[model samples]
Target chain A: MIQVKDLKRTYVVGKVEVHALRGVSFEVEKGEFLAIMGPSGSGKSTLLHQLGLLDTPTSGEIRIAGVDVIGLSDHEKTIFRLNQLGYVFQEYAILPELTALENVYLPAMMRGERRVYYLKSGIDILETVGLGERLHHLPRELSGGEQQRVAVARALVNKPKILFADEPCANLDTESSRQILELFKKLNKDLEQTIVMVTHEEWHKEYMDRVIYLKDGLIEKM
Target chain B: MFEKFRVSLFLAYKYLTGGNKGITIFTIFILTLVFLQLVLVSAILGGATNRFNELMIDYQTGNVVIEPEEDTEYISDAHRLMSKINALPEVTGVSARIKGVGKIIYEDRSVGATVIGIDPLDENTVTKVNSAIVDGDFISKLDRGEIVLGREISGGYGALMESKSLGGVKVGDRVNLRIGSVDREFRVKGIYTTLFFLVDSSAYINKKDMEDILGVQDEAHEIAIKLNPGEDEEEFRKKLMGIGINEEIRVWREFAGIVELLTRTITQIGNILNLIGLLIAFVIIFIVIYINTINKRRQIGVQKAIGIGSNVIVASFVLQAIFYASFGMFLGFFAMQYLITPYTVTHPIQLPIGPVILSLSNTEALFRAALLFFATILASFIPAYKVAREDLLKLIWD
Candidate 1:
């Protein structure tokens, strides 16, 4: 369901150019739970960002569900992301002012679905993430684990074909992190949800169907 | 477009209601002050202009005046014309006056003045000069040699042009008036000051005495007429013309050349002050909204990331600014009409011209409100667009 070929990204900090991704190529099949693992500054998060269409790479090609996302206009890209892709940030980036239910339903609302349909879908997804009791709570009112669950519910509300998590549990404690990982594993096994997650922990590879390792901006192992 | 507007509105309402209450209220308060500043200068200038017109109507020309036809010295058979004018139902009062240029001599000083002869009883019905006596009683119609002098001619009661006056003439002091070949000694019964320098340079005496000096019987230089409230002066002039009264008739505004010039000068200054007030409002609102939007940079990025469209985010901020401006203008208009203006009516502001009240025309108020609304839209849109259009990763992370 996804394809990448020689995707490269670079950044200029002051006068020096640092290559984050160098000639990396990979692909994931449908219904697969994949984990991208690497040490710090090894292009793991950079690759996820490129595939998620959150940032454009300096050079390369990427296709998800057979659409050339890199060639789409900015507006078309936003619509594509809204309709087909979802992202969970490292910070559990739900809007602070919105209630959990509101946060989960926002993307569906932007997609122009009926209010009742979006509300029901948002509620069902929140319940699936074990956050049914925290539907009306704000981000600040929820614990770290509960807020992360809300982010997961938001990502799933649009029924995206591909879900991307960029170190989603970077700020969580050990128990909360385990709960999030178990929820992801259940989603992949029961619902056949395809997810690409980036992590540094070696134990997280146990829940993944396939694992890829990166070293110095290039694929080192698969 | 409608859907986008709906989203923008939702976000604006949520932010305004759920955001920091102190900042919202403070920004609204500042906008209210700016609106007031925008209109107060013009309102005060309007009040001064109104006051000027009022003085002319009250002390110089009663709503309408009838002068002699062109190339003629006087309106012939003035008494018959006065009676014909008084016969109309709209005419409240009419008075005929014989005017002559002369000099008034008191002690060793003499000053040029316009000598006017008025029927004291008829003059009282047309003008409020009778009520403006500051020193002594107004002259009675039967008092033949008694006269009334304005402070500009009498020279002591805070006269603006005191040096050009007759020095210090006192009530009951005898003053000599020289009109052409006619010179008469008269007792000053009263001194009045209208605070209008032009109107205060004239002296009044009994019409019978003026007729004898000017040697014209049953003729007048001009006839002043007062009408009931809401009477149309031009329509009345047409009615007089329809009656075959062929004479030069004019509304009081035609006699306001000098006052009109003064008001125009003040209005120019008022326009400059209004421009400065709008600029200050723009800078103030821009800074307040810029800081507020800058603080929400990460939130804006998240909204954009979740497919909220950059246009929607920017429109939300513009909507907030419009709400702020609308509320501020409404409160300012309310306070001016109900509280500030009424207070001035009870306790007028003492200006050098006279006691002045603020006059706020709805047209001017509405025009200024539109200008303020424009300023608010531009002030909020710039910052919101700047923040929303930035790089997405930088927005979410930095």
Candidate 2:
């Protein structure tokens, strides 16, 4: 479960202050698949970043699993991110030097898991994402859709409590985008995995348990 | 800490061997060449100094020497002092010499040379003068009236001699010697060379002949003493002073003032060379790692975002530097031990002081290797820190 109370974020470009999030507040219960929909610069990605502990909020309170995470130190935040949350970026940000298996197991490795345990878990997750045959291929050798599947497998390998995806299908074709969305639906239903996704597509609303729309920096509709 | 180090080491090894094989091999080659240069520069300087010291000890000064007292032309009661010195437990051999300046004339050519009168048998014990003979035999008695001409005095064509010829004086040729108001004729028994300019320009004769010519019988101008192996010359000098001998005593190091200065000069040059080597290594590693980390800036940010600490990323780069430096130094050690040292020892480089052979002690080699390793660490640290501290969001997005 996640909770946010009046979270705000701002950035200074040259001398002007741009408020990316203006006291926006929201919550998602455990096992819920949520999507945040908005136009460009609606603070959708900004809100996700703040909730995911990727960046600090200008002013706000954020609690995950009933614990205040806003006050955690940098080191504590890194540990929390490693043990409790995972991220899937739009660009398929797998390390080029690592094989698909290496990329998937990296987060588990960072969590101080043993190599054999993480390797087995990573292979199982890759198989679930239908990438069992490409475990040894590098990111560059994989097709765009396959690379995205590897990224998804990597995000799920650590068995985190929540997965944060920022425009995961933004760079995929129509068919790949539909496949990825179906994969997310299956993960949510079969594994009871909780996920928060940001997207601009209107058709993805059918798969989400709930959809929140934003205009400018505040919640406009739900 | 061990876990972190293991992960770092794994990442470093993977990155090093994974991509751009040409660049990796080129960088390693450059490091190997630099390490070899550092070893050779220091070895050559040390070799030159050691060669000079060996020559001075072998051909000129023994471990210790006693000269005439200040303001005295010759030592008084020289035979009594010699006997006392020879009685010491540390003394190995003692040679008393009568030194005088003389003009030598042979076959219408003449040159001024230092004439030394030495007891042949005793002189052999103090210094390897007999082994230096290049022509004819050494004088067998103190009254042979035979003179051994130094290679420089006889031919005047050697590393340390002037170009003026001595009329091509050869063995079995008779030469005239004039010291003060005494003139004598003696046959040139042999030509000997010590490879030292000063020693090779002097002539040696029977001690009895020198006494008769100079009218200073039963006195010696110098007494050279050779000590047993491992005996400390300065300690023995103090002990000899305890015997109440009234003469100026000096060690071989003190007698060879020029060689001492040369040793210090070479050591200072070696220090400068080491500094230059360090600077070169630092710059090379800095640039190599800087470019490497810069290329991986985005990957570094992604790693940080995925809960990897900055320390782990920095450790990976440092480990890469350590690998390159350690491997290069290891190869350099083998090259010095198996290739350079043996070749130089067998065919020494001819120098003005003497023949120079490479010298590399184990401690010296290890110290240089460690110095280079630390320098590489520092070099890699600077760039790694810069890359590690960058804002992750900008790196990931930009």
**How many clashes in each structure?**
0, 0
* Candidate 1 local Cα displacement, residue A131, angstroms: 2.4
- Model 2 per-residue lDDT tens digits across residues A1-222: 999999899999999999999988888999999999999999999998888888899998999999799999988887888788888888888888889999999888877788899899999999999999999999989989999999899889889899899999999998998888999999999999999999999999988999989889899988
TM-score versus the correct structure, for each prediction: 0.95, 0.84
User: Tens digit of lDDT per residue, candidate 2, span B256-337?
Assistant: 7877677778778877888888899899889988998988888887787778878888999989888888877887888888
The alpha-carbon deviation from the true structure for residue B257 of candidate 1, after best TM-score superposition, in angstroms, is 2.7
Model 1 residue A115 lDDT?
A: 80
Task: Provide candidate 1's TM-score on chain A.
Answer: 0.98
lDDT of 1 by residue, B71-113 (tens): 9999999999999999999999999999989999988899999
What lDDT score goes with residue A214 in model 1?
Answer: 96
Best by TM-score: 1
Candidate with top lDDT is 1
- The alpha-carbon deviation from the true structure for residue A190 of candidate 2, after best TM-score superposition, in angstroms, is 3.3
Candidate 1: clashing pairs of residues: none
